[model samples]
Target: MVNVAKAQDETTAAEANTGVAIFAGGCFWCVESDFDHVEGVRETVSGYIGGKSDNPTYKTHTANGDREAVRIVYDPSVVSYDALLRAFFRTVDPTDDGGQFCDRGHSYTTAVYALNEAQAALAEAAKADAAKVLDQPIATEVVSAPTFWPAEEYHQDFHAKNPIRYRYYRNGCGRDKQVEALWGDQARDGIGKK
Candidate 1:
């Protein structure tokens, strides 16, 4: 069995120096791409989580109730979790339980997978703040993090590796349009702007 604490520490190379956050925000590709633009984010891995099956793959994960997710490794000294939360809120339509944008499925639902009690509280606070801003109840779930199974290698850094395709997909999906409409001037606030 893997020692989760040790695995998390090793994942970032410096246990005390690096911080990790997991987000199931619609499509993992877009979420990974967005967080990659954040200032303190050291790395982002596309993955699947909150599933009944342990070894669910790309094709079958959704059937197991897994949602596409991203695991972000960041430096708290550079970006606070609160900032990450705020950034997260701006990136997606938190009120949409039916899925995000053109993506319509349970796997496309948004969630903040809090790795600890602190994160859980922060997520809830962020959701409330977002709700206040949008004047709507947030549908995003804040739950304790479960095992994050990384997606196939081809899914990693998809935006970087396949920029043209990624751009086409993003545009066709109307993700930016929707986020801009929902968050207005603050859409993607903490990404490259950070």
Candidate 2:
């Protein structure tokens, strides 16, 4: 069995010195690509989680029942989790609580996996704040993190590796348009900007 405490310590240390934050925000491709424009994020990896699967693959998650997720390693000193949460809230429609964008399934649902109690609390508070700002109850789940199985190498940084296809898929899926519609100007102005 893997020691999550040790792993978290190692990851925290890596960030303490390197400013990295690990995040799984819906589709790894969109999460990875959106954070790419953020000035502080150092790296992002697409992967699967919140399931009882071993060594999950992209096809398994996308085609079968795995979650199309991404692990974003960023610098908290450079960009706080609050900032990451802001970007996350902007990029995806959290209220749906369903699979993200064109993807429709439990594997693609909106969720925030916390590495520790502190992170979990922060995510919960963030969701509560969202509920207050939004006129509806928050449905985004804040749950204990599960084993993050890295997706196939080809899925990593998919948008960067395939810009033409990435744009085509993103535009065609209507994710951005949907975000604009639900969040309205809030999407462009950030969560509490309205």
RMSD (Å) of each candidate, 1 decimal: 3.7, 4.1
Residues 1-194 of candidate 2 have per-residue lDDT tens digits of 22236334326434554543345556678877887777667777777876555776765665545566666677666777777776776678788767778877787687776666666676777777777767777666776666677788888888878989998988998888988887777773332221
lDDT of 2: 0.69
Q: Model 2 residue 148 lDDT?
A: 73
Error (Å) of candidate 2 at residue 81 is 0.9
Candidate 1, residue 123: how far the Cα is off, in Å? 0.5
| Candidate with maximal TM-score | 1
Q: Tell me the TM-score of each prediction against the true structure.
A: 0.92, 0.84
Q: Given candidate 1, what's the lDDT at residue 191?
A: 80
Off by over 4 Å in 1: 1-16
Candidate 1 lDDT at 31 equals 94
Model 2 clash pairs?
A: 19-74, 19-75, 20-74, 20-75, 21-74
Model 2 stretches astray by more than 4 angstroms: 1-24, 62-65, 188-194
